[model samples]
Target: MEFKDYYKILAIDEKANASVIKASYRKLARKYHPDVSKEENAEAQFKEVGEAYAVLKDPEKRAEYDLLRAQGTYRSAGGSYQPPPDWQSSHAGNRTHSQRTDENFSDFFDSIFGAHGSDFRQAEDFQRSTNRRGRDLHYKIALFLEEAFVGCQRQIALRVSEPDQNGSIKQRDKTLNVKIPAGVTEGQHIRLTGQGELGIGGGKAGDLLLEIEFAPHPYFTVDGMNILLTLPVTCWEAALGSTVEVPTLRGKVKLKIPQAANSGNKLRIKGKGLISKGGEISGDQIVTLQVSLPKERSSEAKALYRQLAECESHFNPRQAFER
Candidate 1:
């Protein structure tokens, strides 16, 4: 068997960290995924990459491979390469890391870590079993506040693991068109049946769990199911009621400001927020009033303020201070 340089196959430094190894595997896996990749021999290259990751991702396997490389055991010029003479007598054969069968790997890999003796038959039999369910996958999706309020449909592509007739796992691309229901809050999970990793043998496939997250909005804040907004108004509007246009998830609506309304006061706009998942209850929009004053007052405005202060002179706005 030809010696396989797992590090070179993964295109990483010999001393690459665990995170770097994992990241490189994902990038290369996507690049050569059979369903999406257009490169020549894409399927073969994809398999090689997966094999490299399986060895490098495991610390024990990587250490053993490194030792072989360090001793120049595999650097021989012969067309075939083999492990040290004592490899079978050592712990390499019984080293249990991956659950995959020796056939999933090349003869070079089998030479180092393959099963031996009476246990070999049991291992082969176990690998052929088809009663194990596939693995479930989790993915996070971000939605705009508007989309969450009214619901939307999205199409997403993902790389999933599948087993061939030989029970060897392969990477493949799967696309799903998903409907995001209205009122999906942050951290909510939407499960799609049998959309995850393919099961071994004839076992059932796993489900895909999509975690929901909300993108930040420039004009609104969320409080549970309620939508919160700070509506700015002139000081005069607060003292002597006025009608103003307020933005809601549905659209803009005219809101009535009660007479003598003060800053920090909250007004509830019923049934204007998010809807319940079952469509039974609707949250109200909470509008908080913030009174604003003119930054630059004209001479006429100053005179009007003086007259108003005089008219309300007995109101000593801070009379409680004297007590």
Candidate 2:
């Protein structure tokens, strides 16, 4: 695994606060969203960004990461600092020994952090006394909006490393059958017991925390549990109240537009948003109205517009701005 510079990826100062880290993550995530970005290796870059954020976003992890980085404790293949005999034994007692290994990191990260391996025996010993379960591993799984509305099952592949008979570490692939419950919201986590890193000694294995992320829909954006959609309506539809068919995560629904409704008006559909886990709590869908004008106007249309203009000659739309 290569060393990762979390501050560099976020383009923030070392003293950046949690809010700054969160803002940076949002900006970077939007830019590298797989559905929209065409950048080379965008997916890889995005993953790297996520990893960086995952560490920096948490105060405890960030502090530990900063300490290790400052100590120059990491040893890369070509680094001048060499570990002493049984270096693992020296730091074996450190709580962050496993984290320092960076085994889960990429080669690029390993190059920076230095290639280190965890001492399974030491970890096992530590667990024998504490009897504490291992920390849960978190992963983000992206789904479509429809999938959020209708539950689905997904087969997920995970890579794990284990010690071989010779004590060398080997990578293994594990497939998990995950059931996505309906009404699952983005940022929510599903816990799978004994699916994370194995516990040391006889302790219980860690739980796998799978965070939900929704794919960007072409027509809608989600906020909290509410769904937002910018629906284009004809001028007549806005001037004359009409019931229009609108698309939702479930299906098409009829929405009533009040007469004289203007562009940018928002209409709410109650209990039409994402359902809660227990199928009891619900949210709303907000539809923003947009009035589209005809690109090409007929002669009669121009005449009618001129006639309307004569009646509204005194109306100065920009008067407020001028004042």
lDDT of 2 by residue, 1-323 (tens): 34567899878999998899877765665455344355677666665666677567656556666766786655656654433333332223443534553323455433323333443233223323433354577788999988888889998988765333322336778789999998899999999989986543224668889999999899999988899999999888898889999999878999999998889999999988989888888888999999989999999999998998898799886899996
Candidate 1 stretches greater than 4 Å from native = 1-130, 163-174, 316-322
The 10-residue segment of model 2 with minimum total lDDT is 119-128
Error of 2 at 49 (Å): 44
Candidates in order have lDDT scores of: 0.79, 0.71
Prediction-by-prediction clash tally: 0, 10
TM-score computed on alpha carbons, candidate 2: 0.57
Angstrom error at residue 317, model 1: 4.2
TM-scores of all predicted structures: 0.57, 0.57
Off by over 4 Å in 2: 1-135, 200-203
What tens digits encode model 1's per-residue C-alpha lDDT throughout 1-323? 78899999989999999999977876676566565456788777766876777678778778988888788867678756788787652435464545435544666766776633324444234323423578999989989989998899999889998765333468999999999998888788999999988765345789999999888898898888899999999989999999999999999999999999989999999999888788787888999999999999999999999999999888875789999
Worst 10 residues of 1 by lDDT: 122-131
